[model samples]
Target: MEDQREIAYVESVARGWTMEDGEDLSAMRRALREVRARALPMNMSMDLIRRTAEERWSS
Candidate 1:
């Protein structure tokens, strides 16, 4: 049903927006720091990262 689907979507978004799992959020902070560290040194944009990662992964 549409209502059930909407409820599921809202629940998923709520879960992401909240720390119900006792998540420390440090992993995300560390990942962001790593991204900034790499990007700043190379002047990389989001597109560059995506393309580079794709090429590296595919080869």
Candidate 2:
């Protein structure tokens, strides 16, 4: 049997978030966009990529 891999499964991975109520959703999406541009080409693991994205959102 071949081993299976799950990609982009949000529940199985750690999420980086600490948003207060009423935060701007557009801002969060912008941050994620920047992080995605940087993280996607680093050849990093998905967990690392997600963590990085979260940091980008907060920062």
Candidate 3:
């Protein structure tokens, strides 16, 4: 499973959003960590994940 930091970084990149500095960034990271921890795992293959990511970015 991917860590919170990695998930946050990927989400930021995917949405083309700039990560703010200071306390806001810390809060955001904390929230993401919590959310990720509660999320269910998907039984998908790497190819499917890659394809989905590609499709999302390509749109």
**lDDT winner:** 3
The full ranking of all candidates by TM-score, starting with the best, is 3, 2, 1
Candidate rank order under lDDT? 3, 2, 1
Candidate 3 lDDT for residue 11? 47
Model 1 worst lDDT run, 10 consecutive residues: 2-11
Q: Rate the local accuracy (lDDT) of all candidates.
A: 0.53, 0.57, 0.65
Candidate 2: stretches off by over 4 Å: 1-23, 42-59
| C-alpha lDDT of residue 35 in model 2 | 90
Estimate the TM-score for candidate 1: 0.31
Residues 1-59 of candidate 1: C-alpha lDDT, one tens digit per residue:
44542111123644644332223345555676898776644545666888889999986
Report clashes for each candidate as comma-separated counts: 0, 0, 0
Instruction: List the pairs of residues colliding in candidate 2.
Output: none
On the 0 to 100 scale, the lDDT of residue 35 in model 3 is 91
Q: Output the worst ten-in-a-row residue range by lDDT, candidate 3.
A: 1-10
lDDT for 52 in candidate 1 is: 87
Mark the regions of model 3 whose C-alpha exceeds 4 Å error after superposition: 1-19, 44-59
